[model samples]
Target chain A: MFLLQLRNELRKLFGKKRTYLGFGMFLLAQSAFILVLKYGRGPNQSMMRMMQGNGYAAAHFFSNLTVATTTLLATAYVLLPLYVSLVGGDLVAKEAEDGTLRMILSRPISRLRILLIKWLAGVVFSLILILAFAVFGACFSRLFFPEGGLFVSIPWDGVFGVFEGVEGWQRYAAAHLVLTLKACTIMSLAFMFSCFDIKPAAATIVAISLVFISKIMQDTPYFHDMQGWFFTYHMNVWVYFFAAPIPWWKVGESLSILAGFNLTFFLIGSTAFQIRDFKS
Target chain B: MISLRNVRKNFGGQRAVEDLDLQVPAGEIFGLLGHNGAGKSTAIGMMLGQVWPTAGEIRICGHDIISQRQAALRKVGAIFETPVFYDYLSGWRNLEILSHYSAPTSRHRIGEVVEWVGLTGREHSRVRTYSHGMRTRLALAQALLPQPELLILDEPGDGLDPEGIHEMRLTILRLHREMGLTILLSSHLLNEVQQLCTRIAVMKKGRKVFDGPLSAINKSQSWIRLRVNDFPSAVELLRRERLITDEREGSLIAVAPGSGTEHVVRCLVAQGISVYEIAPQEQTLEDSYLDLMKFDGPAPSGKQQLQPSVLATEH
Candidate 1:
């Protein structure tokens, strides 16, 4: 029964023109940016200089682009969250705006189940967007720079880290798997806000604002003691995928905290929605 | 069967529906009538479980709405104030998606219902392209899709033309007569309900003011019809003795106060007029409603104040 409802939600989610808007934006950005990175001359020298130790000496084929490290990270940090939040923020709030929420709730289905189906659909969409990012960013960047060892750098600590002699395919696949977790977590937060009485655009704006605020607080030296508590800190856990040996413990801890965040938000949204009067 | 016990709803500090206890039996077309701000919509909302009742118990087909929400809702179908749909999708797809929650429904049933509501030709059009009346029809189609035993419709005639209103009346009548579908329709359109419903309840400022079989309010014993041997003598004798106050259409419509049917017959017969037949015709529902609206005295307690004798003398 729930599967049927989820299928319906997915249909409504994809039917709107706005759903394709984000994907189109990503395709354009990835193609245009990768074009300059590959063909542009003097600019490439400054970028390649960031390569530590040998300094682009043993670079594979042309230079620094690896699906796991460079292109994927560029898309993941900004574009993915904006797009995921759009659909996630729309899941329930759109029904309310359309005045169809009353009709849907009047059915025999439980309120929690109805929302769960929508949330799951949003999670599926979020995962699809990230996976597509990995594929498109990897394949598109490959046209410019040859497949090479992944280039990874920690924030502020510009000390470079490289994964050499490792199969790029295996590393690329692992990085996407971790990225899916991050996408699902951010999308779920947006979905929780969508359950409120506000409009979908407002919900999307609020979700994105929370992400930006967390990112800022995590970067600030004043919030060092509470750094681990911010979701923005954990959502970047995919970066660990490019380390010399995958830090399984850090990945596991980060994923657990995100799972906890998803559960808490889902609970709060469901309770608030069930108690609200649709007529009001 | 639908029952509401001590139902009350308060918005912030103001009350919307106050201590409303309504019970409508199965297979009856019940009209819930009220003017603007009469809490008609609010009462319907509580029945549909869209608004939480501040204090009460509502049961549909023996299932409590609060504790057994799914069970209670299974037998119920409804349309709130206005019809709303996904404007992006065709009307057909909207129904297809909504029917998923009410599982085991068929594509054949969907097609049949759309046709039933007269949307057969335009079912494939996007809802945004539809006019208000078409959207209302689509809402009706959605409500009928569940094949519910209890249908609660709020202002179902708001967007209809005169002909459409006539068709809607027939459709509701057919649903009740043919399918045995019990309906509770809330509206301010007096004539619509007066022509269609078997029973009705009126609301005033968040409180239920009157409820009873329509006949109780519309029927009048004072307006008697009679076919006599001599028309002139009967009229003259009744007028001379002052037995009737008003006469119309070859009948005494309003009998004089302190006079009964027996007195009129005796007066006419004593003057050599033979009375053949006598029958009472009713005033329209409009007349009864107007009278109720103007009354500034005590209110009734549910059905207790609905005694036939008390209502019969209001005129």
Candidate 2:
């Protein structure tokens, strides 16, 4: 029964035209980047200079690893949340607004089961989006820049920190894999808001604003001590995979915190949803 | 079988449903009759576990809703107020989604049910394009998909055109008779209730004003109106005996109190007053409904329903 309901929910999510709009936007962005990276001399020259400074001998420094890392960072902050929340935030609130929640609740099943299926479906959609982003980044970037040794400087603390990497394709795949937790966390937050009696757009906007506020606080000097608790701090944890001698402890901490956030958001959502009367 | 015992629901100290107790046996089409704001919606919400009751226990087929809700809800199918659907999805998709939680209603069964509701070709269209009547029929189709033993609907014919209303009535009738499905109908339409329900429970201001078999409730309260000779003497004598409360157009209307209309006639003839004509002033279910709603209001009593008489100028 659970599988049946989850499948139905997946069908409903994918059936919407808006779901494809996100895919199209990401596809265009990735393809455009691929075109510029291959032919644009300014970006290529800058990469060549950075490679020389970082002690790399390769003429082209933008490999599959760098491209995947860049894409994960570039889109995960803004575009990913917007698209993910578009569906996640609408999971329950839209149903309530459409008055279908009352009709659906008329069945023999429990409210918790319905919410579980929806959340699971949202998680699945998030994974698909993350995987698609990875594939697009890898395929498009590799078309322009071959598989070369890669490196990127990180703001580990208050100074410039170079984390040189030559893990080849392994790091690229791991970077994408680690991002699922981040995507799930953001989508779950949006889904938690969706369980409320608010409008779908309002839920999505609030979820994005939460991330925005968290990101700002993470950058604020005074909030350095509190930054670890903010979700955005953990959301950017995928970058750890790009570092040479990958920070497994930091990555595990972020993964655990994200898992906790997902569980908490789900609990809050399901509990709130159970208490709702659908006032329709 | 269904039973609501001492059920009460209040919204912020304002009572929505008050001490509502009801019972509907198997194979009975129980009409929940009330005007708007009569707490019918709130009571139905409680029964469906959508609204939390301030106080009471509701049982369906002997399973209590407070603890054994799923067990109780399994046998029930319901449509509340307007039939709600996913406007973006096709009618087929809507049913397909609904069938997931319902008791394993198969795709083949869905096809049969869609045709059963007379929505064959239009199943591909989104529900946003469905008319009010079509939406209702679709709701019924999904509600019956589980083959539930009990079907509950609130104002099923609301907003339907006359023909649409007639069609909805026929659909409900067929579902009840052919399917032998127990039905609970909530509506302000008295005639619809009269035509459809065998038993009824009337709500007035969060309270059950009346609950019984329909025939019995209507039969107990009706008038026996008579047009007679000598209006002045007729009024004086009937008033003296307190048999008639008021008169109209040279006639005296006796409150039958249910049966024995002949006794009033005999009493009138004993006075040697010539009886010109005699007939029972038919009281419709509407009148009965009105009386239930106005039970506490200062309206004409059974006797006071009689208006002041006019003298027969022909004499």
Candidate 3:
């Protein structure tokens, strides 16, 4: 029964047009980046200068993997969070606003089970969005650039690394796999707000606003020492995958914190959902 | 099949239901009648475990609603006020999704219910394309999917046309008589309640004003309708002789309980009033509902021995 309900939840989530907004937006952003890199200007000047200074041919590193990784970096912070929050914020609040929650709540199932199923559905959606970003970026970039080596640079996180052949592909895949943590954490935050008595749009906006505030605080030099306390700092730990001699301890710590955030958000959402009247 | 013991619900400063005690026995079609804001929906919401009662206990089929909510709700099926569904999904899909919330329902069973509600052909269409009557039918179909012992329908015929209302009434009657499904039907349509429910409870301002069989309301209060040549003279004479307490238009006269219609006719004849037509007028559910709402305080219940001539007309 649980599996059947989860399947139904997935079907319901994917059945709506809004569910594909993230996929569509990511596709457009990735395609535009690929076009600019392939036809307009070859990779960024600073990235080229850094590679040349490191004694590697800058042109040799201008491959599909590089384009895909760079495009993901540019959009993951803004577009990915926006779309994840959009879906997560809608999972419960939209049903309540549409008055379907009253009918569903009238059934024999427990409220806790209903919320768990919905949260699971939101998690699955987050995974799918991240998967699509990886696949689309890789596929679209391959159409415009040749496959060769990979170069990654995120000066903010102080990560600059170069790899070749299988190692480059493995790291690229691992980076996206780790990115799922950020997607799920942001989604869980919006999902927690979705359980409250608020509109879907308001829930999404509030979740995004909090993320923006956290990012701003983490990025500010004055608060650099305090970055470890911000959720955005942990969320950006996915970028650590590109660092040479990757900081395994920092990665583990951030993963633990992200998992805790997910659990805490779900518990709070379940509590709010259980006590709500669902008058609609 | 259902029971409420001193149940009450308050929405902040306002009370939706105040100390409501009700019992619906097995195999009985019970109507919950109330005007807008009388807490019929709130009471039903509590019964279905959607709204938490501020105080007291509610049980369904011998299970406590708060503690054994899943068990209690398992035996019940409900169509709450304004049936809502996923407008993007087809009616068939909607039923399939909603049915999974309770027990698993077979496709054949869903098809049977769809046909039962007269929505067979339209089940393939999205709910956004459905008419109000079609949506109501779909709601009924979903409620019937789990083969529940108790069915709770709140204003099921609310926005239906007269024909649709009549059809809904027929469906309710069939479910009660053939399937032996105990039903709690909340509606403002007194005529529908009169035709369908065996017993009813009327709410006025968050308090249950009346709860009894349909015949009891008629039996508690009755009037004598008369068409006389001298309407004014007959009313004056009846009032002068203390035979009638309330006089209404069309010469309807309210006599005290135990005052038979024949006796009233004899008294009118004795007063030199020619009564062309005289007949006993059994009070309808609507009349009783209006009377109950008119009172500022708690109205009389079935246990009360009411004198219609005095109490019915009193504001």
Candidate 4:
């Protein structure tokens, strides 16, 4: 039944013309980011001069591009929520809007099964979108800056370090994986919101608003007491992977908190969807 | 079999369905007759478990709709209003998705239902391009794909043309005759219900005023049509005798319930009125329905009041 539902979800995602809108936007954004990183001149040159003055080699271009690409991708967090909303928002609401809920619920399968399938399918789509971003970012960064070195900047610590030696690839891969996981957590939250709302647009707006508001609130001194509970405070947990010795304690706490949020929201969503009347 | 006992539904503060009690026997087509706001759709929605009833019980095949929803729903199939489907997917694929939700249905069964609905040649076509009639057929195909015990169809023939209506009627008859599927069809069209359903329940303002076998309901009312040569004198004589309540169409007089056709003919002849034809009209389901509605209260606007026996026999 799970395989059957997954197949159906895949068909709906690819079969409908509306599904392409999200993918198209992702491609366009990635292309624009790549173009700016490749041809545009900015603080990269100024930082390179400072690095050169500090006796760093020019071969550290790849490390600089990695930093640029990471920052650019991070700044483009808008796409993450949009991608999650596109798929997640339509999980159950679309079925009701289309008048297919009656046909689906009339079947022998339990409501729990349907919710599980839709949630999993939404997760799968979210994962695919994140992977697409990672692949595009990696290719574009490599094209502009092919030389290998490690130029790490600690934004919160107000310090910069350059490691021009072997084992740079390991560090880059580790950092990329951690960043992907962080984005996955955001996608999962958006999906849970999708299951709760009836309108796709409304669900999308709510998901984006939650992330945007939390981020803004976490930066405020007035919200100092509430910052620990905000998902936004842990949004930068990916930075721990880039630390010299890798702060396992902070990373573990962030992962645990994210996992807890994901599980709690998923449970609430499934329970509500299972029992709620789906008349639209 | 499907049964609803004291089922009531409220939207905000307004009552959509009130104390609705219905029992549809297995292998029988029960018609739900009502005006636009007569709570037919609300009752059907609750039966399908799409909306929870504010009060009372709905049981399908002996399973409670609220407590044992999956089990009750497993035996039911329904089509509400327009036949909405995934326009991008082919007709065959749409059925496949619905089939996955139910029990594991085979590809051969899908092909069979497609053939059953006369969409064999066009099964591969995208549903978006299909006409309204074709979509209705596809919807019926999907509903029947699960081979459910009970079928709930709301205005199934609403958008069909003459030939489409004929074809739909034949298809519905085939389902009941061959497949032995119990059907509960709701429609405001009296003639359609008379032709299809053996029993019917009529709703007026969220209340069922009449519920019984179609034949019995039709038989409950008496109609007398008299054709007299002296139309004015016959009308005057019947009015003076208080034998008839209304007269219309110049030559035809509609007599009251207690006045027999023979007695009216005798009185007309005694009054020197030449009686051409005097016969008791066979009270049709439509006539009985109109009479019932008139006694209950004024029917809501735009209600289709079908003609009596003539229309039923002619068709």
User: Which candidate has the top score in DockQ?
Assistant: 3
Model 1: CA > 4 A from native:
A52-54, A58-69, A157-160, A164-166, B219-315
Shift in Å, residue A12, candidate 2:
1.2
- The better-scoring model by lDDT among 1 and 3 is 3
| Residue-level error in angstroms, candidate 4, position B217 | 2.9
Interface DockQ of each model: 0.48, 0.53, 0.75, 0.54
Clashing pairs in 4: none
- lDDT by residue for model 2 over A1-280, one digit each (tens)? 7888888899888888887777888878777766665678887677667667767664545666565555556666678878888888999998888788888787877889899999999999988988888888877777766776555555553222233344556666776787888778888999999998899999899998998899898989999999888988988877777666677898889889889999999999999998876555
- Per candidate, native contacts kept equal 0.74, 0.60, 0.74, 0.58
The weakest ten consecutive residues by lDDT in model 1 chain B span B306-315
Candidate whose lDDT is highest = 3
Provide interface RMSD per model, one decimal: 1.5, 1.4, 1.0, 2.0
Q: Residue B309: error of model 1 in Å?
A: 14
lDDT of 4 by residue, A15-96 (tens): 9777667667776776666566556677456556755776776555445445544543454457755666556666677776
- What's the residue-level lDDT of A139 in candidate 1? 74
Candidate 3 stretches with Cα past 4 Å from truth are A42-46, B226-243, B257-279, B303-305, B309-314
lDDT of 3 by residue, A1-280 (tens): 8998998899889989999988998999989888877776445666677778888887789789988999999999899899999999999999999999888998999999999999999989988888888998898898877888998878878998889989988888899999998999999999999999999999999999999999998989999899989999999988988888799999999999999999999999889988888774
Clashing residue pairs found in predicted model 2 = none
lDDT of 3 at A279: 78
| Alpha-carbon DockQ of candidate 4 | 0.54
